[model samples]
Target chain A: MSLDQNDIAKLARLARIRIEPESVADLQQRLGDILNMVDTMQAVDTTGVDPMANPYDAFQRLRADEVTETDQREKFQAIAPSTEDGLYLVPKVID
Target chain B: MPSYTVAEILQKLESRECSSEEITQSYLDAIAKQDGTINSYITVTAEQALAQARAADELRAKGDAPALCGLPIAHKDIFCTDGIRTSCASKMLDNFIAPYNATVVEKLAAAGVVTLGKTNLDEFAMGSSNETSFYGPVRNPWDINCVPGGSSGGSAAAVAAGLAPIATGTDTGGSIRQPAALCGLTGLKPSYGRVSRYGMIAFASSLDQGGPIARTAEDAAIMMQAMAGFDLRDSTSMDVPVPDYRAALNNDIKGKKIGVPKEYFSAGLHPDIAAAVQTALAEYQKLGAELVEISLPHTELAVPCYYVIAPAEASTNLSRYDGVRYGYRCEDPQDLDDLYTRTREEGFGEEVKRRIMVGTYALSAGFYDAYYRKAQQIRRLIRNDFVEAFKQVDFIAGPTAPNPAFALGEKANDPVTMYLEDIYTISVNLAGLPAISLPAGFSNGKPVSLQLIGRDFDEAGLLAAAHQYQQISDWHRQIAPHAV
Candidate 1:
């Protein structure tokens, strides 16, 4: 159940969060502790118990396909880190 | 004015004994003087609050005012406030001003409640103690060195210190109730979907629920009347009819069956908290309520189950905070991966990053069934325990937390130890049942709370039971020493 540096690195990559090399050991230790605590659930036999995702077992409520929202592109884009032509600007992915 | 509870202030407002502007000014003055030491508020909207109070006074003069009109309340920064900074006590959103009001804020404002300001919270509502907040830890009003339990610590501390009459708080696990318990205030976590989550920053979408923190159950009821309802904007918002919470506050609990879960009185619990809960149970018995010793066999698994599920959900919800659309961004990103990774790493606090990592790992490909699905299956078992207990009793009673507020840095280094603070309260959230924490007694001069868990959507009954107890007890009336 313990996480090593490689596992921590992989998790950070998957989660898209960078962990400094110095903090990785500490993270591994703390995350290992948390996982150890979470491992307690393994002791209970949950055979055939239906997984409950939502508390009420309520399904997603469908709404009609309608354009209810007013255009607030300018208002919203005003707060973005970077934007151009009402589209959010991010690091270029295209080669 | 500082000594009055929300209910008392409401009477004064309705009777015109004092003007709304005066009450708002008094709270503003108090916050100005006391909040420096307590660190309760992240932002204080003094000008806007006074403007809203004056508008409320104008409405009152015209003989048309909403039920909670003119009341000043603080909002947990997690709830977005239009044109105001809603930080969630994190550096990520420290510069982000919300474009729209959260449904709770909008609804409360519509009901004539003036906004005092947004209060501090654990970063992304991630920690048990307020120490995780980027704004700094909210000191317990009772003792300046201790923490006001979080992530609703600021809301609880603000209300407990009389900086605000009532404040809104969201409970993903025990954020609302634990802080309320520690601060010696009444905090309610209504049934899941009972309140709209629209615009409220999502920590764990399934578990996150907004409720009221106040000095008494009556005040909480009044706040709940303005808060609980269905909103078309939120997909999970319930369609059930909202009840008159205040009307049922005085209902007699004769022959009511309150189940005392044996597992809740385990060895991990503090002796003082156990004694306080026992005394409160005896008081309930004297009020003609019968106590039944019940068992929630899966109680021990709740913490583990919640840790897995909440983090998994939080990891997904927080992914939206990439450097693109809004919120904090890194200085120079050479590539897309660098942008996301550096932004998140630098923006989020240690606890938030820890949870995101835990959640990502739990939902990762190979470990999905072992962690995520297994936890969900156990979540069903934990919920079933409450369902069965409710069948045998009208409500479940226990101590809100294992212990009272500890020193600020006591559990900061220990994550698991901090996680256990919500052991008793998390199960109710997992089960999506309504629960309330009432100030039961004091332990070593710190506050201890008695929690009452009710059936789904039964907030009226839960508040009534809490209100009945408050009628006979003076614990909730004991203001923190700093406030006094």
Candidate 2:
């Protein structure tokens, strides 16, 4: 149940967070300690227990398909990191 | 004037003894004089507050004022306020201003409550101590050298110090109650779906629910009455009619049965805190309430279960914070991957990153069952314990936290030790029940708290029990020396 430096690096990549090589050892140790605490969950027998997703077993409420909110693209896009010609700007993906 | 509770302010406002502007200005003045050492506020909306207060005065002049009009309150920075910075105490969102108000914010604003400002919290509401806030740790008003239990520490501390009479706080796992206990305030964490979560920054979709923190349960009830209601914007919000929390306050608890969990008095609990809780329970007996010893068999499993579930949801919710969207962007990104990686690396605090990594590993392929799924299964068992207990008793009583305020850096070096600060409070969130932390008494000059748990959506019961306790005790009215 322990995580090593490599495991933390892989997890960082999956989670899209960068890890400095120096900090990787620290994160590995901390993550390992956390997992060890979480490992105690194994002692309880959950053989027939159903997994609870939401505390309230209620389903997501549905509404009729309709436009509720007015167009606020201009207002929303105002906060984007980079916006030009009504589009969000990001680094080039294709060559 | 700053020391007056919300109920007192309301009476004053109604009688025209003081204008909302005067009250709002006094609170603003108090913040200017006191918040330097407290660090409770991330942003103080002085101009907006005065403007709102003037509007409330106008409404009163026209004889159209609402119940909460002109009252000042501090909102946890986690709830978005239109055109105001809602950082959730994370550097990633430090520069971002919300385009819309959270449902709670909108509801309270519409009721004419003036927004004093946004209070600090753990970055992304991830930590048990205020030390995780990017703005810096909030000092406990009771003792400046000690930590205010968080992620609602700022709100709790501000209310305790009389910087504001009432403040809004959200609890995922003891974020509200733990801080409330440490700061000697009444903090209620309502049932899931009891309050709309729309525009409130999500830490865990299933667990996060906003509530009120104030000096008395009556004040907390008044704020909750304004804050709770249905919203189509939040799919999980319940459509049930909101209860008259204030009216329910005076209900008698004669012969009511209260469950006292034997597990809560475990060896790890501080002796002084345990004694304070015992004294409070005995007082409930003096009020003619009966106490029955009960056991929540799976109580020890709550921390492990919550850590898995909350962080798992956080990793997914925070995914939208890539440099492409509004927030802190890494300077000079080489590519999209670098943009996200470096941006997140530089933006989030250490505790946040630690949680993201833990959550990612738990939800990752080949380990989901062992961690996330098993934790959910254990969550059901933890919930079942409450269901069984509630069948025999009207309420569950225990210490809100294992200890009172600790020195700021005392447990900073160890994450596990810090996590245990929420030990007694987390199970309520796990069970999705309403709970309130009552300022019971002092231990070594710092405040201790007793918690009362209610059935789902039964905030009225919790508030009534707390209000009854406060009616007979003066602990909740104690003020820190600096605040005086």
Q: What TM-score does each model's chain B reach against the true chain B?
A: 0.99, 0.99
* Steric clash pairs (candidate 2): none
- iRMSD (Å), candidate 1: 0.8
Off by over 4 Å in 2: none
Candidate 1, residues B1-484, lDDT tens digits: the string is 8879888998999999999999999999999999999999999999999999999999999999999889999999999999999899999999999999999998999999999999989999999889999999999999999999999999999998989989999999999999999999999999999999999999999899999999999999999999999999999999999989999998999899999989999999999999999999999999999999999999999999999999999999999989888899999899999999999999999999999999999999999999999999998998999888888899999999998999989999999999999999999889999999999999889999999999999999999999999989999999899993
Instruction: Tell me the lDDT of model 1 at B215.
Output: 93
**Residue B86 alpha-carbon offset, candidate 2, angstroms:** 1.0
- By summed lDDT, which 10 consecutive residues of candidate 2 chain B come out lowest? B475-484
Candidate 2 recovers what fraction of true contacts?
0.84
Give the DockQ (2 decimals) of all models.
0.89, 0.86
The per-prediction i-RMS, to one decimal, reads 0.8, 0.8
Overall lDDT per candidate, in order of appearance: 0.94, 0.92
Worst lDDT window (10 residues) for model 1 chain B? B475-484
User: Candidate 2 residues B1-484, lDDT tens each?
Assistant: 8779999999999999999999999999999999999999999999999999999999999999988989999999999999998899999999998999999999998888999999988889888779989899999989999988999999998998889999999999999999999999999999999999999999999999999999999999999998998899999998878889999998999899999999999999999999899999999999999999999999999999998998898889888889786999989888888999999999999999888888888899999999999999999999999999999999999999999999998988799999999999999998899999989999989999999999988999889989999999999888887673
TM-score of each: 0.99, 0.99
